[model samples]
Target: MSYKLSRRKFGQLALAGTVVSGLSYLTNRALAETPSLNIVGIGSTPIITTDQTTIPEVNTTELDSTAPDSVSTDIKPVGLVLQSLITGKAQVLADKSTPLLELNEIVSGFTSLSDGTLVVAITPITTSRRQATPTRITFLGTPVKTLIVSGLKQNQQLGSLLGTNDGRLIGLVGKKNGTPPIRLVDIDLQTGEISSISKVKFPNDERVSNLAECPDGKLYTSLVGLNGDTTLVQLDSNQKKPIRLGQLKVNGQAWNNGLQSLVCSATGQLLAFGAMRYETPNAVYSVDKNSGNMTRLQDFDTTQITRARG
Candidate 1:
């Protein structure tokens, strides 16, 4: 079979082939660069205690070297649920509910360091109140290292842990018995010491429930009132106070539920786990930083997720 093609025809065919190859290269490059976000969540079932009348506090001050070699006798075993989600999706990709430390500890806070190391604050369950032991900070990895928080007061507990882009760990410290003031502080990863940053003055009835740092290095927090009203506030590092954005709204209607966790993806998308009303299962939402609007993404079953980090 002998077929002769003109010069113009051959040129057209060559150009078409080049265009197809270029398109394929571009597509592959995009896919390689834009990896799916990996969000991790840690939670647990409610802690139940058999003792009611007399409660005892576990002396955590002595057990601060590393993760306990074995589960303490005072611990009432409960499973700690660890789950993961991909970017732009609400469905959990995997639910590996492993009983780390025999599920004897309650996860009070969870966040990732700048190098993607998972850090968790857990308190050993000693009584029904769940407040008889000091909260210890631990790193989750091959060998879990439990570190003692040196500067935290006996009545203060740290929550809403946020790892900043500049490699600093920040958290919200609140009182156990009385109303909590807006106290933001920086925590030392090596020494487990905490130093006070400037305090944000918010309303007495409202508290800074959750905190997240965006890709641009700006910090945002959710102010939740006693009536379940949530407002998004932006904290500027240059200033001492935070700028109130507005009340959070879903589909243009005011959101009536509280946001359990707030996290910003590497792609600059703000995500949250919100407490929906009417007994509906908790769901994930994409938050609008400018207007305080939330768009529901997908419904997730876990309700006790203290925080999520992407």
Candidate 2:
């Protein structure tokens, strides 16, 4: 989804890629105070690491997720991705029947503000390709509506995007003719305003494949492998050059390099990427963020697992 600027923030230049790359619906009024949420994990498809950040659908065949609490906000999943070809506009699919959140083209992506208030990115009415504005809902509960902004404009079209603990900044991608395919944006997390620190692009940055941010707000972009390593570079705001590392890929795509993901801890632990074959059931490993050591998170087949976009 895209975000807002009072000038009409056309978003989704906000949606589309990391280079690229879900479902459940259950609505209940006053679900806010409900004790336990009824959730299901219908399917767990392994989305292989690609050049883009992939948001997997939360398949709900049957699950028992914690219901809406005071802090619990229900954002119905609408599976969507932008096409590189751009012939047709990107589409979102609400595969479920009655969802908690009702989004029209007027809406892009949504994230929760830690405070009680809802801050959103809105798409300006002037957006040519899409209809929705990237705005935030006042309350995700009964009578859901958008929180208003003062003097918001159209340049804000690349509306507010939610972030993951892993450091994926979910906002719009703004592109111009001959420019790099994607532009990284920072969301204010409040008021839904776009930051002057708005766009980020790398040299020869073709399409952003997969991106992961560390707990420290440092971001790592996953690129198709070149040379000896499946690469993920660390960007330094002060320095022009990035710190580079070589990740080992167990998946077949690493024929040229290794499959990679990066993680960092505030306490100074540094965990680089490593993978083993997942025989059908995948084994997860946690790298020592500070030491670069590997520890197991879950056990699965590195071999049974698949390789993806180089």
Candidate 3:
């Protein structure tokens, strides 16, 4: 549905911060008003920061009224999916792969707060001649406050944001230029500052894909090897090293394609979106936290989704 604010409301939003143009302000409000458990995903698209005036308004379409029992009764269906394309617009998907809203900036990762508000990690576009820009931590609620994250180097970017049960915001910071060690960090929501927690040392040729926090407060990560072998690892809260869980198995065999996104539902079920091979159709899988075995839940289109949070 189209969301247009009155001129008075527009003035208020403009004064608060750089207002996100178009229906995003009202669309976000609509999402906030309705309370439901949603699984959010973001696509991998390079975005560069530009003048606000040059950005176009966000495009939106009517949402599907029927929320189908697509995935399963126990788990929530994929609700909001954000994809950044070459057009510099972010598309939101609801039930089908249909686009609902088009945003100006690229959303790399997002997590929900205790109050159901969303904390999003946005990476601004970088030009070939310029160094990478700092990722912005945006709180999507009433005022839509945004903060430039500090303590990240020029070649580093934060993804896989997870809001812990105790209210701590954690993220995985990875290097852009080379395969440097990926570090887990605590992000200060108020100050947009980050402090190192521990470096995730993967086995030779293994790289981390995403991170998730379960209801019981345990953290998990999906690692991909050079041969496309996928492994699930657990990060103990008090320990510096990660414990290797098994390879993510499907039908008693290792899932060849890596899991692009990992999220733990409120019901304590681990879920992920991955394919059997690269550039194939994606499917939702219920992951066994203990054994890393996966059961297929639903299938999706060939659209490339990079990260997920529930």
Candidate 4:
């Protein structure tokens, strides 16, 4: 007495639902100019290169270094989050169970393959998560690749993974204990492997927290000055000396609290970074990568911008 829909009716309903989703997305985007289309204190927003068009998607912890997955841009009606936030569903990974990969056993350095596949740089660890040894980069069935040194390994708790374009892996930009602070690590896209680069030499020796590669391939870093000033730094594609871009200030506010994270958009025009503030919800703002200027893009009243009734 309950099941009444026929196969033909079900197919029609599915198609109708997709159309409705598409329409709702369009309706929501029309008012996208209102600030608050973003989340503060979360992670960076990523826009995957599609055949055409750049869509805003939010990065969730699930897509963090913990899993090998990616969501597509320019391919969907939309998602609830801001990433290349392709609103519909999570992108499929070649191997669902592939483990997380970190840079120098500390930072996360992950990037997508040319076809948008996620490359994970996992080291074989004890079930308890102790680092026994790091393995050469290779997908489970792929041929042996040279991304790891035979007998050298370290801790697995310092850094989170970073993802980049196909040929290159995500590099590290953080400090290492009991050693001169190392700033960056390079990932080999071909081998799913990682290699340490050089530490940034700052006369002031600022405590840098995170680094992000903008769509233009320029690595933007979040540096905290010794004097407790939070600022933005732009590096040459080579990631050498960071040219001081000054602390990110918006609407007459000082960035003394510092940036919690950094992310950039496809055109490099929209750079988003999170500010660390305990009392208020985190803040996400857009920056002009070239001029180092920032615009207020979000705040706690975001629901005033995100809540919509269709």
Tens digits of lDDT, candidate 1, 1-310? 1122234432332221111111000112222333343455555653344777543422222234454332233333344444544433322121221233324455656788786556777655454665554566766543444565667776677777887888888888776432467588888887667888865565667777677888888788888777678899888766666798888988787777777788887778777786556657776677888888887765555533323332
Ranking of all candidate structures by their TM-score, best first? 1, 3, 4, 2
Encode model 2's per-residue lDDT on 45-113: one tens digit a residue: 223345676444332112123422112223333322211110112233222221222233233333332
Deviating ranges (above 4 Å) for candidate 4: 1-31, 34-114, 118-162, 176-180, 190-192, 197-204, 226-228, 237-240, 299-310
Quote the lDDT for 251 in model 1.
Answer: 78
lDDT of 4 by residue, 249-302 (tens): 666565666554465444354444444454465445667655456675544221
TM-score of each: 0.71, 0.38, 0.65, 0.50
Give me candidate 2's TM-score against the actual structure.
0.38
Look at candidate 2 and tell me the lDDT of residue 1.
21
Root-mean-square deviation of Cα positions for candidate 3 versus the true structure, in angstroms: 12.9
At residue 161, candidate 3 shows an lDDT of 78
Shift in Å, residue 206, candidate 2: 3.1
Arranged by lDDT, best first: 1, 3, 4, 2
For model 3, residues 1-310, the per-residue Cα lDDT tens digits are 2223346543432332222222221123323332222353344322234554543332221122242211111111112333211111224322222121123334556666655455667664454665433466766444545566788887777777777777778888876522447778999876678999776565545667677777788888877877778889998856656788888988998888777678776667777777887546676577887788887755544232322232
The whole-model lDDT of each prediction reads: 0.59, 0.32, 0.56, 0.38
- Better by lDDT, candidate 3 or 1: 1
Show the colliding residue pairs in model 3: 1-62, 47-125, 48-125, 49-125
Which 10 consecutive positions of candidate 3 have the poorest summed lDDT? 69-78
